[model samples]
Target: MRCLKMLVIAAVLMFGLTSCGVTNHMISNYNVSQTQLVLSKDNFRVIGDVEGRARATYVFGIGGLSRKAVRENAIADMYRNARLTGAQAVNNITTTVKVRSYPFVMEYEFIASGQIIEFTGE
Candidate 1:
């Protein structure tokens, strides 16, 4: 009976830790800036490459993890990083998702990358 109780407690603790989704520290440390720019013209010149990543976890499909949320977060992170470098736009954006599963827990990571650009207006 004691062994069974211990097992139950351990399982609950693991679930609690894994269900918290992404951490605030991870999101806050990206140092993304809030700036808007138009990325639809050839006048923009490439400054450099930038990337963002976010993670979500699911346990027996109980967690409210969604691909849309992961994707949005990744893009937001990318934009923030770009803006910090004084970039006026981002282009050639690409997104990728990776999945890892272990018995009851499944984790997904979304990554976004793009080239930072500035409008030359030639």
Candidate 2:
């Protein structure tokens, strides 16, 4: 009976942890400038730095998580953050992925960061 109770407790704990969904992070200023272009570093003048991240957790490796999905979500978040900074565009974009593993679960985060910029017609 004691063994059965311990097993149940462990199962509940695992379930609780797995059910936790994605986490996100962002840093930006509220006074954003409106613009219609997503530019590269060479095409724009960087005004400030912006960052965004998204995380997804998998239980027993069962969730159909894909890199493309994660990356897209992170990029979307970055764009939103850029808008918050009133950027005309985002430049110098960089992306990274982090994974953590436990006995029966894994958590991964997709992180995207970039510099907010304006057009420099040089």
Backbone Cα, N, C clashes tallied per candidate: 0, 3
Candidate lDDT values, in order: 0.70, 0.68
Quote the positional error of residue 119 for candidate 2 in Å: 0.8
RMSD of each: 9.5, 8.7
Q: Ten-residue segment with the worst summed lDDT in candidate 2? A: 25-34
Candidate 1 Cα misplacement greater than 4 A, ranges: 1-42, 84-87
- TM-scores of the models, in the given order? 0.61, 0.58
TM-score of 2: 0.58
Candidate 2 stretches greater than 4 Å from native:
1-44, 84-87
